[model samples]
Target: MSTLQNFDRRRITGPDKSLPPVYDSSPSAADPLASPEPAERAHRSPSSVRPIFLQTGLIPSASGSTYLEQSSQKLVCAVYGPRQQPKAAGAGYSDRGTLTVSLKFAPFSSSRRRAPNRDAEDRQLSLRVQAALEPAVRAETFPKAGVDVFLHVLESDGLDALVCGAVLAASTALADAGVELLGLVVGCSAAWVGGRTWLDPSEQEARGARGVMGLTCLPALGTVASVWQTGELGLEEVEQMADECRRACDELHHLAVKVLLESAKKRLGRS
Candidate 1:
């Protein structure tokens, strides 16, 4: 999968030579081609996440690829391999294949440009995504092969949303790659603020929240797979956040499945 192996990650910083940037969210941005920011987030409801757009198979050279957007945040995921397991120092034989996942942010993804290299937060988010999706993949099916998932955050609106979106995008990319899967994983997040849980908070909105949470699940199986929480929350509030996030995840799963089904039908017709 040369496309996946050679995806244009390095040029992710500037506007595409042909297309105008429609996802920039930096407050200080002055690019005339950059789309205006969405309406003030304060007007959004507490029970809803931002509306989203998802599409797959965009990278013809990759086994599978997908791009997803929710207002200001844009993420792309590419999957490669089911090929040779790289023989590294002291590598041992394995009955199950391995999955190597990395998440990186484009330098201009945030208001304050991020470093191009992976940082501590990026590593942490990568592990969280890996842990959430591993349970759904039947890795033994590939034996000595491996699958590599690469996630590029082209833009970001919030830390919680970034992680949640990464999990959602990666799982969809794996399924699109035709990997053996026990089930698909979906993610949702919320912030506890003003004595209530905000379904999905933007970075600007979450600044003063008392707590934040991110949850991932296998909606088809009705089971939660991972949970990440921060700040101090009472037991009652924690329970509420989990419940809200789970419901949101289920809703997201329905939307994701619908899109995947439609894409599959089109592919079948083309074949």
Candidate 2:
């Protein structure tokens, strides 16, 4: 059996990497890649090479909320509002809505303990997450109010893939909040494996994997929203990666739509 000590953090994040194992068992830190395990795994066969968990309605205070956990990697998202303007006086509030995203990783959320607040990595994730979400939201409808979306990463089995999950979590939270969306935004990723692209590669896989890309899209419009890639790949390979990413978004959108509708009904009953 490989003990926890056998996996070196540096090696995992090193320039040359390999496949990170994927699991769909517990929602906790057992594998660390799966945070809150996706409830739909039973529908997917054990043999499916690409495994992911899709979940929603996990946050209460936000206009809406959603949680996605794959293996031990986990993200909890909350959509706070079309609420009052922030502290910036005479701040440029557009006819479109303003979105402010915050990303935080709990100290115990990773294999190595992290600090309590936003570190450099957290700040970067917030920026990337915002970029991924902005295109799909129709901000003009909310006027001066800003929608505050929070992403709390409880665990990160594969650091790179977890960021992709954060993008998905934020988009779902936005739809759940009912913030006037142009279309649902969905995110997915592909990692370089051997001579081919690994769709949704795990952390370990990421270490050995050469290049990775995180893609976000507007499913209804059939348009690309954001494309983020790290490392290297050929132009033709990149196009193929985008195509695969769009497919992932389409599948994820179905679950997002179902969750948002169910959440809206619950909110109506409570109100």
Candidate 3:
């Protein structure tokens, strides 16, 4: 009898209220948003790179993993497999192992919220990563196997820089996983603004720039692995940007080597 009918109760909702307008209370001199002086801009170096922090073995469950940070950009990469290949009918056998790269941006990675599904940008970045890394990895070493690299961007300040960082991080993770590699892959990005090339550009600078380029290299081999560009630029400008990007990659290569050495030392000590 009680299940036959239910008593209805009216629910009261709170009235909508508009937020109060915010105002700056600080003096003009102390305002952070104020533009910098001409002298200050002249003194500031545009070619400087953001400090990089790289570490490995953070994910014990993964075959290999790395964490990389530069300014507000942060990402983690995990490498798995070189194990048995999947048995899917379409998964044709390869004498050399295949490299499958997947890149995802966390919902909070950017200023705006991102969806969990992979977008066109994400797919393109994944392809770029694979291209940059494939040359460096000795995939043929493991026959009929596959290596899976998963990159998760925790934060993103610049899309170009984020892709570059992911390239470096993924290669490092593969190496940490004990995968055979021809050479470590190092990635660098540059922004062409006002007829000048700025290396390792921040998000704001990248947005304001005329063009952006990302380069990945195999340091030991002294060869460029991949080059990606956006926006229009002349041949001369492209050459200049490429040269700058190569130099930056070389610098990053040194730092990456040091990090890997330190990580190996720690592992040896533990063993």
Candidate 4:
């Protein structure tokens, strides 16, 4: 963690649809976070899903690599690290490893074409993704050398769920590369919509959300790394949403572990 957290919280307010408001002024009456009470979780009829799928060696130049797709989201991650340390006096580490993350939205990934330059939205998301995985990574061990994690969002169905998908993808890729982690980092997003909570919201459902929450968990440790909530909600309502997010994360972890195993089998030519 950096000293940036100690700085005065900066506020930004604009009429932008993509940017979150500096201060929530949409009135608690209509605010999703400010809902009167938590709604029951939505359930869908069980269907057959492969459990997990893995893409190996996508980044030829990287030390370790993998790509994964869960439901509607698709992500590709490459891990490069435990390598050279920057020739600086006070860099990251030398013995262990540092994780540096770069997240980008591919041009054809979105319904609209992505711009080449990193936008404010991209910067915000990259920062969040990095923060979500920090607790699971052991940075001090690397000393001056840092591990590089790259994420390419191959698609965004219009849901504000990029953080969740990216977090899981990044962690899965690291695990696939055999990076030592405190535990698996699993992430999922839930949206409060139509007086009910929806798990793994589609692009449309996300945009209609009252409050969108993204949660990351360390399943083996039985701990939560991060819980991000935007929009408005009452205390009890927020707690309920948190519970839903936890359940969703559990599902994602199952998929992630399956992917890790598949990745290993591919490397070993098991099947």
Instruction: Flag the better candidate by lDDT, 1 or 4.
Output: 1
Model 4 ranges with Cα > 4 A deviation: 1-52, 88-96
The C-alpha TM-scores of every prediction are: 0.84, 0.76, 0.84, 0.75
Candidate 3: residue 174 Cα off by (Å): 0.8
Indicate which candidate wins on lDDT: 1
lDDT of 2 by residue, 1-271 (tens): 5766687765324356667766566535443234322222233331122455766676555578888877777778888988986568766645766899998998778766686653678888888889878887888888877899888888887665676788778887777677888788777888665556666766655655567887888888888888888887888878887787777778877877876676667768952
**Residue range 63-165, candidate 4, lDDT tens digits:** 7777777566687888887677567666543465667788888876776667657455677788888888999987776666677888888877644466777
lDDT of 1 by residue, 101-209 (tens): 9999888788776876646688887898999988888999999899999999999999888888888888888999999888889988888877888888888666657
Model 4 gets an lDDT of: 0.70
Off by over 4 Å in 3: 1-44
Q: Output the lDDT of residue 132, model 3.
A: 94
Choose 3 or 4, whichever is better by lDDT.
Answer: 3
**Tens digits of lDDT, candidate 3, 1-271:** 6743553333333357867646557545442235421112232476767889999998999999999998799999999978886587877667888899999999778867676784567888899899999998898898888899999999999888888899989988998999999999988888887778888876666666778888899978999999888887788998998988888888889988888899998878953
Count of steric clashes across candidates, in order: 0, 24, 0, 18
